[model samples]
Target: MIKRITAGLLAGTLVLALAACTATVPISPTDSSGLGSETIHVGIAYDSAGRGDLSFNDAAGAGLDRAKKELLVQATEATTEAENDQARAETLRGLAQGGSNPVIAVGFLYATAVGTVGKEFPDTLFAIIDDDSVSADNVVSLLFSEEQGSYLVGVAAARATRTNRVGFVGGVDVALIHKFEAGYTAGVRSVNPGITVDVRYLSKPPDFSGFGAPDKGTAAARQLISNGADVIYAAAGGSGSGVFEAVAAAPAKVWAIGVDSDQYASAPEAVKPHILTSMLKRVDNGVFQEIQAFAKGDREGGSKRYDLKVDGVGYATSNTALNRYKDDMEKARYRILSGAVKVPSK
Candidate 1:
């Protein structure tokens, strides 16, 4: 009896030790003050909605918040429209340059503006999300794989939809939106070769003006639903709210996917029931990680892609909503992560 008890106790200890090892986070770059960094000053320039859109800007801001709270970083932001992304970046860059502070810019929209800013303020240490739209050694560009996350959502949507038709509502025709659209369309095709994907943009490809217009987004959603689309993955910033409103009013089953942040809680109750899941780009992780990198002396220039390969992008279905689909989701996820299944990034 004593021998049996000893054996059980030893087995339990080994199981707990194995669990701890499996849960350990792989080490990435680190900073000076130990917890990612000491006191790194940062300036955030985001989309037009400022901080409450619960999407890209909010996700990035969350990261900045983490840096300030956990890494002892002092941070500020430049909240302005797409056209003003560069202007705001310049304003922040000036501050960073004068006092030896680092300026962090959010959003892919800042691509064009940040590259020039990096050139003018070579010492400012410009870290941007979604790349600088070009190459610059002074700037650390962070880009994510929206397609990878969107691909998972696409699979879920295809499997869940009874209509076999879905919608893609994009903020702008920029490369970022293209990443979501391309991956979503391909994912649907991968699952069901004949599924119909209706793609629509809130604004034209070159027009950055429509990044936060909700009215246009709602109108676009209604149109997509009218044509029999039951599920839509909306990448349109604030405009996505309008899309949610439209879907909520539908009699037939309608689902509108949220992006960047956990938008499951952002919309009306009726609309949320139909939401399949969210394609989280982990912007907050990117933001905080970049700030930490700067603190850790990993200021190597050029673009750093937060792609699916690095678990940078992923799907977020409600714990309850996806509970039933966990098996399917896990299988798909492992395959993509292992490269056993290729998710097209077209």
Candidate 2:
């Protein structure tokens, strides 16, 4: 049975801690034969943004930290430099070769790498986040209903907007981000059929630098703000920081919605007030549960989905600004949970 991992506040500053570093740093290995060892060494290969993205990567790191503290597991982490399949494969392969069992690839971009490396190390179990296309006996896919959470945040944005216009900024124009856009747009429209929703993507596929480019995120937000959008939701990973900056600098009051984590807690002091809410994807829970399962000797592999039914995806309400709309959002949440409202994932 799939278990629910409780979401908690991350302990640390929210700044992009490793925004520039991009090299593989291997940790000392433990017993390679995970079967008979008292301690298990875990390995994680993050996407280009790495540990300090303050969004996706940070969530994953939180889980790793919890495992170390509670499960007593040793772990080594690496970030992809070139963001290509070759670099990702090498990172996974290196970790497996170093005796790190149950190596994890943090983003869907590592799908090809996971498939390639999982075959090479059949004895070592593997997990990949955000993607489940890989078919392997030793690999488990950790998937999430990102669209469901995005829909909740979209409702929040629609309710908070003063101009009756909202905006969406995506890091890349990929199918994954598309799910975010689809649900968010639907949520906004559900509140008001005539609301104007501005959508922009920082970069398209093949040039995924948008995920790490704050400058681009700022530019996108500015454009939306100029178009009279008072509430903006950013699913642009690290670029979401730029969206918050733009909203904070806007002449009139505006709100920015964050993705993946409780960005209000991590945001700078000045920007915190402007953040309405964030779509909580609960990647930390996924990471922590996977490690916990492996530690308990559950090696079965396949696709495991985290959806609204499992409390895997939802909206954060840290800011008091969201308190006023709590009932509305909660009603929407009930509809989603009851399957009365089927959130689109396209």
Candidate 3:
């Protein structure tokens, strides 16, 4: 009886969503070309840092690419402005109504917007990365165990520091950002408990530009360095690039740990070697999986959390970049996964 009711409900939802297809935004030339016979249109709204950050946005886009090539999906990018979290959500809704197959929203900025849109289009398979939780039945929220990966980064920053003082510049002060900060601080303390960590955000409570702006991010990093932070962890996005620039110009013993993707190669040559490691948030993989599930009729909505156990998030030390620290990073990774160490989160 339960299986029969479930089948009926799903069939009914698909019917309703198809009726509302007229409400979605129109497909553009960029999204139309290269679309094959088996293609499914996917909308990816990126963070303010934009596509070439060589970081978070690029990684998420890779996942969409995987879905496109493997499953013949079509991808379109929707860029967001600084502090315009709500507007981004509306944009996601527009893409869905426009007949996009499975829309993926990157970052925690889309959480609330996804929640609202999920309710409006019950049959739309929406995938939101970086954060989770959905009130609707058809929305799949892809969240990472960022805390676990952050702990490894914290250790890297501490170990790389010459002054024994480190800094953390966060994108925002929300719970999700806080998770990064808290886990990082705890990880550093585990390596050297007395090391002081100076924490700062780009904005206060609601605004989220601490991750977007390079100028402000550079200024904050400079201040921390001036105050004796020899190493820093940048959970801020484009803002983090600023920290890299500041470190390059600074005279002190300075280095930075980048977040989201493999940033060693993305950084300028001046500070390229100074890159300790990167916190890899597998945003793209998560999105690709959800879209594939939809294509195979296995899409499940609501909140979803992917952790180190699932390779959702972790820190990476590339042999091409940080050969010296590769072993240390591996040790940290093993410790976290083995449960010998527990990383704290907010």
In order, candidate lDDTs are: 0.72, 0.85, 0.73
Which tens-of-lDDT digit does each residue in 100-195 have in candidate 2?
788888999999989999999999999999998998889999999999988888888888888999999999999999999999988888888888
lDDT of 1 by residue, 176-195 (tens): 68889988887777789888
Q: What TM-scores do the predictions have?
A: 0.84, 0.89, 0.83
Say what the RMSD of model 3 is: 9.3
Model 2: pairs clashing at backbone N, Cα or C within 3 Å: none
lDDT of candidate 3 over 1-346, digit per residue (tens): 0001122322222111111111123334465333323446666777666677777788887787777666665555666553454566556666666666577777777778787877777777777776655556677777788888888788777777778789999877778878899889988888899899999788866666676788988999999999999888898877888888888788866888888887886777777877778898887778777877676566577766778888888876662545655577678888888989887777
TM-score of 1: 0.84
Error of 3 at 282 (Å): 1.3
> Which stretches of model 3 miss by more than 4 angstroms?
1-38, 82-86, 319-321
Shift of residue 93 alpha carbon in model 1, Å: 3.2
Worst window of 10 by summed lDDT in candidate 3:
14-23
Task: Write the number of the candidate with greater lDDT, choosing between 1 and 3.
Answer: 3
Higher-lDDT candidate of 2 and 3: 2
